[model samples]
Target chain A: MSFLKYRLRMDKNVHLIMKILTVFSIVTILAILLGLLYKAYPILKTHSLTNLLLSKDWFPQKELFGLFPFISSTFQVTGLAMFIAVPFCLLASIYLSEYASKSITRLVLPLIDILAGIPSVIFGIWGIILIVPFIRDYVAPFFGKVSSGYSILTGGIVLAVMLIPVMVNILLEVFNTVSRGYKEASLALGATKWQCIKHVLLIKSAPGIISAIALSLSRAFGETLAVLMVVGNVTKSPKSILDPAQPLPALIANNYGEMMSVDLYDSALLLASLVLFIIVLFFNIIARVILRRLEKNNH
Target chain B: MKFKAKFIEERIFKILMITSTSIILLSLGAILGSILYKGLPSLSWEMISQTPKGGFYLGKSGGILNAILGSFYIAFGATAIALLVSLPVALYINIYRKKFSKYSNLVRLCLDVLWGVPSIVYGALGFSVMLYIGLKTSLLAGIIIVGILIIPVMIRAMDEVIKTIPKGLVEASLALGSTKTETAFKIVVKQALPGIITAILLSFGRAIGDAASVMYTTGFTDNIPKSLLSQAATLPLAIMNLVSSPIVEVQNKAYASALILTFIILFLSIISRLLSIKYTKNKSH
Candidate 1:
């Protein structure tokens, strides 16, 4: 009887502990949102939304805080990187799901995992020594006369390389989940293997693929050190892909050391990060909803 | 001669597919080939064991020993913290609640969103929170933020492993009159031990390799962190600092640091793979 009582008491303690930890996860999420909001309070209170988001002036030393350039630069780089990787990811995903043999799938998939696991700093290192030089010497000259290696094109290419594996992994999963019967029916109707994949699988899984792209876009939007290393960290809006531009993340990373030196600089920068956090979070949630629908369709 | 359109289309697609697949392989090959080509020559015994002296960024003296040790310290501490939070939350979702219940799904959904978030965003949040609390960039802040960053990964991975445990085994344990708490901690978790190890290894790999999140939360210092409040350097940060410098020797050292970071992630990958294989073996019993 005593042993039974002791066991019950122990179970009670464990359950309480487990519940607290689970709740703590939710707490942390709220804490981060509130913290960023609190830090951005000054700008959100004083500046008009359009002025803060769309103005071109970003001179911190003079106290004018405009986020138009950084926000546009973020989208521009993400758009370029995604544009470059999407077709390759689409084709490779189809190949992985439809045509690759088990041995090849087994081999290629692990390699993808390795590529994904390699850190961003390594990507930054590669960007500085290899991609930057290649861009400056070979690619940039094609665009016109450009002196430095750092620009939007350099940032976009590096981001594309970093994000392709992520896109392929998610898209491949979506493609594989496509109903086998759809393909079989297509082939039975005299469609060729490629036709079956193209008409049946690709059209059916479009939403999932879009979500995968959204997920990758979220990453590209927030990528920092690699972009900072190659993007020249310029403050002005980029006139062309060859022009160096600063994204929100790169701006925050480069200026945090000196932001305190300027009035309202810290508040504005934190506000920029707040905007970034909320945008990325919003995109991620949309991707999840689409992904959930895809999973539901499969089941 | 009229060619069958379907046949021609298939042939063209076959070519396109091969080209696209090769693109992936080619990109991987280029990154690895260049990193190794530049990094291998500069690697040395002293580089791994000594701290930076004056003008280390100029490539004149000392080693990355402090950064290496600091990286190990932060990652190990962060993993330990993440494990404490992740295991219980994962177990609660799997064992304490009805499987795939609405609450469990909501938590899983939240975790999925967290998983897709970029590391730099975490850094931004960490930086803000540190300022709010009047804390400087220190090892403690780095660990706290990183521990938070990896919680979703650890929980989701562990949940996946636990979810794969056969329902029959769980039912049998309940039929034998074991307590839910006992069954969870002793039986369900025991069944998922190999997978738990894999989860830990992967999260450790993530914590150690991430640079952006620590860029602001853990400011770099040449010395090892003496206390949690002390500033510490990390390998990825060291690589970033070195490669950005104008000195040629420092650039070479950056590659060596990358090689070491690569080796650690590779070792973690290999170990996790072996552990997952063991997980499959255990499942058969």
Candidate 2:
């Protein structure tokens, strides 16, 4: 009896130590978020939120730091990338999950993993070589417009490619969650394969799709180097897909060092990062909540 | 006519699916091909062995040894630190707590959130922390931030692997008079060893390839870092810096650097793949 009690006490001590370590990790995450906000407070205090977000001027020399252009560029690029990515991801994932043979599926999953693992800077280099010139010479002229190739369209295409592997992986997993029995039931009811997929599987996995989009959207919004390298970092809101624009990340990456000599520059950059952090946190939370509910429902 | 229309719709959708999937696969080929085709000619023995000389970006003589070594130093250091924190958290969540307990769920939520937080934001945060601590841009600062960036990834990967351990084995150990911690380290960890190794390699690849988080924290230099305090260069940053040059030679060298980076990532992924396969086979036996 005493030996058993001692063993239990030892177990209790182990659990206590593990608990403290786990708690420390959570605290560290919170501290990171708070620390960014703390560093950004000076800029937030000085500039009205409305002026900072909505103003068009971004001249740091005179202390007028409007972020509308960068914000709009971010939205435009991400929106365009999502528009391209969704249909492609839907079709590809549907094919893989429904139509492909096991050997094909096995071959493809690792390829997708490889795609996801490729570094962004390499993608940026690919963009400089393939996408940019293709846009400048072939795509723009075909539309009877001239572009420098480093435009919103280039950025969108590059980002769309970067986002595809992640989106497809999640979506493929989501579609796979629909049991064979469920799919066969719809088919057994005299529905064609397409009808079963379109009406049953798609509807069943709509929540999963939403979470995937939220997760990938956060990724697209935060992507830095590839977009920065391809997108012409002009400080103006793009008037067209062909026009050059600067997203918030590129703005921070490009100017953080040189602009530090300017007053409140650090605060301004930190504020930009804070805004990014909040939006990403919001999307992540939405994804988490939806995923948790999905798991609960499944069980 | 109605039956024929339904059949036609099915056929068309199938075709569309096949086409889109093919396009994705083809682009993968295109990316790999473009890098290899452009990078091969410019890759030289000296490029891998020597540091950059003056005017390296101006079509001058040099290699990327500095960035190569610096990348290894930072990635290895960061992965080591991340593993120190991540293994404990992974074990704690899996071994100490109930599977669906609120605290465990909360920790998972935090990790998911961290995973979604962009590397660029981490960079910004790292820059802030460095300033707050009065640390200069150095290899140490880079390692700290990159370590933070990869921790969630490592933990999530390890957690997934640990979760797949058969309940019977764990129960058997505990029933044999082993304490929970002993069962965890001796049984659970041993079973998950291959996965843990794979997770480490995967995170190391991510750490080495990451450009944004290290951009601000690790100040770029032309030479290999002499100590943790010294500024260090990295391949991704080197590629970024080199590609902007007007000189054709310099741009080609950028491709060569990209080639090198791609090869390193590919090698790591292959190794992890082989390890997982070999171990899973051993387990079945």
Candidate 3:
């Protein structure tokens, strides 16, 4: 009886410890958000948010830190990547989910995993060696333009490749979740396979598709190393795909080492990262909510 | 006429889908092919064994031994730390809380948000924390930051594995007069061990390959780090620095470094895949 009591006491203590550790997970998130905000507050205090966000001048030596160009470049590259990647991923996922046999999917899925696992820096290297030159000499000339190759187009191409595996995986899962009965019902009406997929599977999985895009957009936005290597780190706002541009993540990655020495530089960079953090957090929250709703509806 | 148009549309869309799928597969092949084609020629045993000599980026003859070891040290340290923190949290949710409970859902939500937070943001956060604590860039700092970055990944992966254990297994263990803690450690963990190992290796691959978070927290160094406080170089940063060199030989060296990293990640992925398939046989069906 005494031994039983001792074992119960030990179990209670262990349970309490586990409870505290679990609460620490919540604390970690708060710490990341609050810590970033605390460090970024000084810059937010000194400059009006609009000026910091809207102005093009970014002479950090003179304490001028406009972020307009970076923001524009980020959106242009990410938007271009999404434009290229989404339709391709949608088509590929449809092929994999609806049309392909099991063996073909088995071969393709592992390939996607390998693609997803390739380091971002290697992707950057590949961009430099292949995509940049391909753009400069081939695609750009075909478009009646000349580019040095380290341009938004190069970055977008590399980023699009990086986004492919992620988007395909999500889309495949989403497409697979459409019930077989619905597909059969559509087919029973003498519809072609394509028609059944277009009218039934696509309509059923629209929310999942939207969430996948949102998730990958957040990923492309926060992507640094590959975009940094390919996109010429020019501070000017890019007016065309051929023009070199600097995005926010690249700005932070490139200037961080020197940021500590410059007055308000560290804060400015911190603010830039805080911007990235908040936007990504917002996207993730929306995606999560939509995905949760999709899961609920499926149930 | 309507039937003809419908038939044509089906043919067209099917052709488009096939083309897109082929494009994706071809791009994957191209990426792998280019890396191997460029990287293989420059790779050498000496390149893997020797530290970078003076003027290493200036076409000097040297190897990336320092970076290779530093990457291992940081990845191992970070993975160890993450596993300790994540295991308890994963266990707590599955064992202590009710399934699909509000509190557990909230914790899961927090982890999802954390996972979405970018690596650069984590780098900035780590840099700020270092400033607050008056610490310099070092292996310890890198490990700490990467550990934080991967906690969500490890926890979420482990959580899924733990959740997969049949409810009957836990009930049976408890019916045998064992406490909840005993069932958690002895029964549930035993079944989840294979998946837990896979999660560790996957996160290890992530931590090692990551450059953004460690670029600030772990300052680059020439020689291998002599201590945890010493600045440590990483393979990705080494590749990044090398690729910018004007020397053709040095640029080739960058490719070789990337090849090494690729191999390491590939090896880890395969090992984890095999381990999961091999050891998952005993799981409750």
Candidate 4:
């Protein structure tokens, strides 16, 4: 204890240096926010809030920059992706923990790692080559409709595929956190294995599972290329799942290449980045809260 | 009858679980299978040994050496920079164990939020900063953005591994008059060496595969970046540009790049996993 006090008050140069460096994480966050907001401020100052956010008009030459369609489309694709990924992953995790033996888990875990490691661009190309062709040639024609197979549905499906590994891995860990004794006790009380899972496992893992979903939801929302390639980035908000639409990440990405040519275009795209930043941060905050609660419970 | 119904229900749920797991496996197979099948044939000595020729992207004959080298330079550079900041931060978080104090909680939350920030947003943010400073698309810009991307990942991974070190070992070292830095670097980090290696390579995998952040900041060039100021092409961006080409020849090159990309990722993932597995086994005993 005296040795610790000696280091604490001795002005230990190395410790002091590290204490300063620990602040870099916070500094990095502030720097990114400041950079984004500094560029976005020009556009925000010029445009009214309602006009910038709620109106669907995206004509850039007239300085019109309403992002209603893009924002809505962003949420729609993310929501649909989450809807598919969450339930599917929950079932997969339950199976992994409750039923599958260690050998089966050994075989499957590496594949999940492979899935996680595939580049998003590869996923985009896969969507283009595989999913888009199927939807265009078969699925879209089922309702007597003409389509290019680039739609919110295509984006959602591709995103759901991308999110599966992330959701399953986190939720599997959450499911693992439920102590073994609880399940044993439930079985001792004459409950079926299924009842044990439903009552003890699901109830116990709920916070962790929800937080994982929130994290995955944020990832889906922020994804760019896979959605961009398949979504047929039209500027109008999608009226149906099959309609192509633009989201904020896609809009900025598609335009940023050509942004140097247009006046105020860089600022406009930066504003969209800010919006994406805020939305992802919002979901992350919710997830952090849930995880902290879980941590406290564990202690 | 009650036992029969319960048995059937369990069987059905198990079927659904295995089926879902199969879909994930199938997706991996199909993606890699298609990329390798289409790409392996086109991966040639000429293709990998030289830069792109005239009309190379339009299905003409050329190589992706520019991108391959560019990727190495950028990923290694980014990871190197991220390590400088991340190690100290990870050690700090570990050495000062606040457990779940508000300040520590806030720090973890910030890192998570940074980790979740989409790479494209990082690109956009970098682009704006470039505009302010008037820096062109170059290796430096790419490194900065990709460095930001790798920092949080590296920190979290290292911190998790460091947190697993026995606290009593650290306290004992301190009681014996070893300095805080000496205990951390000499004892704790040495014990966590396997984990630190995995963290480094895992972040390396992530950095090399990312295209969106580098697409704008690192302008595509057929030549390897000669300096920090020079723009460079990466395999991901090369694949993206080539795949949509109307030429069947260019499309084949895209697959070839995908093959190499996948190979690099596979190698990193395998090694990192092995290291962690070894570390875990060592710890458990």
Better of 1 and 4 by TM-score: 1
Give TM per candidate: 0.97, 0.97, 0.97, 0.95
Reference contacts preserved by each model: 0.62, 0.71, 0.71, 0.66
Least well predicted 10-residue stretch by lDDT in candidate 3 chain B = B276-285
Steric clash pairs (candidate 2): none
TM-score of chain A for the candidates in order shown: 0.96, 0.94, 0.96, 0.92
What is the lDDT of every predicted structure here?
0.86, 0.90, 0.91, 0.86
Q: Estimate, for each residue in A1-299, the C-alpha lDDT of model 4 and write its tens digit.
A: 89778665653776677778778777887888888888888888888767888998998888888889999999999998988877788888898889889999999988898799878888887787778888889988997777789988889989999999989888887887788899999999988788788899999988898899889988988999879878999999788888899888999888898877777778888989988988888888898788777767766
The true-structure Cα RMSD of candidate 1 reads: 1.6
Q: In model 1, which residue pairs have backbone atoms overlapping below 3 Å?
A: none
Question: For candidate 2, lDDT tens digit of each residue in A203-231?
Answer: 99999999999888999989999999999
Instruction: Assess candidate 4 and give its lDDT.
Output: 0.86
List candidate 2 segments past 4 Å from native. A1-14, B1-3
Q: For model 2, state the Cα shift of residue B253 in Å.
A: 0.4
Weakest 10 consecutive residues of candidate 2 chain B by summed lDDT = B94-103
**Interface RMSD in angstroms for candidate 1:** 1.4
- lDDT of candidate 4 over B89-155, digit per residue (tens): 8887777545456776677778888899999999988887787799999999999889989899999
For each of the candidates, give the backbone clash count: 0, 0, 0, 0
Model 2, B172-265: lDDT tens digits are 9989989988889899999999999999999999999999999999989999999999999999999999999888999999999999999999
